[model samples]
Target: MNGRMIYLIGPSGSGKDSLLDSARDALAAQGCRIARRVITRSADAQGEAAEVVDPDTFARLEAEGAFAMNWYANGLSYGIPRVVDEWLSAGDDVLVNGSRGYLPEARRRYPHMLAVLLTVDHHVLRQRLHARSRESAEEIEARLARNAGFAETLMTGESDDLCLLDNSGSLAQTRERLLKLIAEHRLPD
Candidate 1:
């Protein structure tokens, strides 16, 4: 079996983490591994369930070529550990919660990757972000401004490589769609 990566990309408050966690459990029996991201954010961060590393360690790891794809966004560094590539090579389907800013590089590294972009209703997004309470008002504003461009690209289909999902509905709806997509795109022997 050839490796096929499933990359989930979305902005803050888009429910990417929740959706990924649900799908991870649902797909575990099928041998899918959810790749844990390495981040410069502290472990105490509220929303993202990532492996937190300091700047020095992150630089050392990046210098050692440990990350498959890494990027700086919202003043923080994020990386998908190279172990995901290893898992995929072993024929296990690996799911990654990736960054929109780094999608091009991720595609170049794993062209066959199934990229899923999750979006949310503007009102819902605002509510979710407020509830998360992870950042100051200024930071939240910056995030919304950044997210707008990504949303526009999805609406315009500039990202034809991605399967778009509006997560304004129940999570079950999103999960089933993703499972179906994976089944449809399953690699042939």
Candidate 2:
């Protein structure tokens, strides 16, 4: 039996990294492996635990077909190592911190993948972004605008494969919701 793909996506500062970190053990106990991304950024970057690579190295790896999936966003390149394919083939569910813009391509490749959108209340999101201090106030506003539109579209869309997980509350609540969502979508043996 092939394992299912759980594609988790959300705008920056929506707590994707935090949720993944907090729920890592629970997810593993449930037979799910979170794919560590190869990103073109410093190892000490303030975000998810991703493999850091130079732009040239990333380009070379992409050319060599080392990634199962890859895309460029926010001035950085992100890749999911091809090992994920092997994990899924071995009947281990795989979760990826994926991109919203790359959803179409991901869906095309993994037709049965569950697309989970982690959402937060606008005020909470703004506060998180401000606390992160990764972007200027203007940039944060622009991102919030974009997130609002994209979120609205997703919420209203009739996509059966899409799951909306709100992360507006405590990390504990979001972690429980995440685990439950995984259980609910687990593939039958």
Candidate 3:
């Protein structure tokens, strides 16, 4: 059987990176591999452990068909390496930190993929974004508003493969819930 794709998406400050980091080892033990994304950003950027590449390099890679998935968001280009295809074909589940706007395309590509939406309370999300210090207060507020709208849309037009995981309180609790969610979706042998 082919392995499932867990496409994780969330707002900027939703703790997707943190949850993925905390659950990495456990997920690996359960045969799930996290795909390291290639992004057009600095290596020292304070977020996910994505591969940093210059715009030229990213263009080259994209031209060469090195990515199974690619999208531009927040003024940066992100790509999921095509190696994920190999892992999936070998029966190893793959999890990707994915884009909310690009989700429809992702779902089209992997129809059976599980869409995990990591969410946080509005206040908690605001605090977290502020703590990052990346965006101004106005930008953060705008992000919060967008997030709220997106969450509402998802709740109303939910799909069978979509799952919502709240990351507002404790990372430990969220990690446990995430593991359980993945386990529940695992394909039977």
The clash numbers for all candidates, in the given order, read 0, 0, 0
For model 1, what is the error of residue 123's alpha carbon versus the real structure, in angstroms, after optimal superposition? 1.1
Cand. 1 Cα-lDDT? 0.84
User: What TM-score would candidate 1 get against the native?
Assistant: 0.92
| Model 2 alpha-carbon miss at residue 80, Å | 0.3
Model 2 residue 64 CA deviation in Å: 0.4
Go through the candidates in order and give each one's C-alpha lDDT. 0.84, 0.93, 0.92
TM-score of each: 0.92, 0.96, 0.96
Please estimate how well model 3 matches the true structure, expressed as its whole-model Cα lDDT: 0.92
Instruction: List ranges where model 2 is wrong by over 4 Å.
Output: 156-158
lDDT of 2 by residue, 29-100 (tens): 999999999999877679888999999999999999999999999899999999999999999999999999
Of models 1 and 2, which has the larger TM-score? 2
Model 3 stretches with alpha carbons more than 4 Å out: none
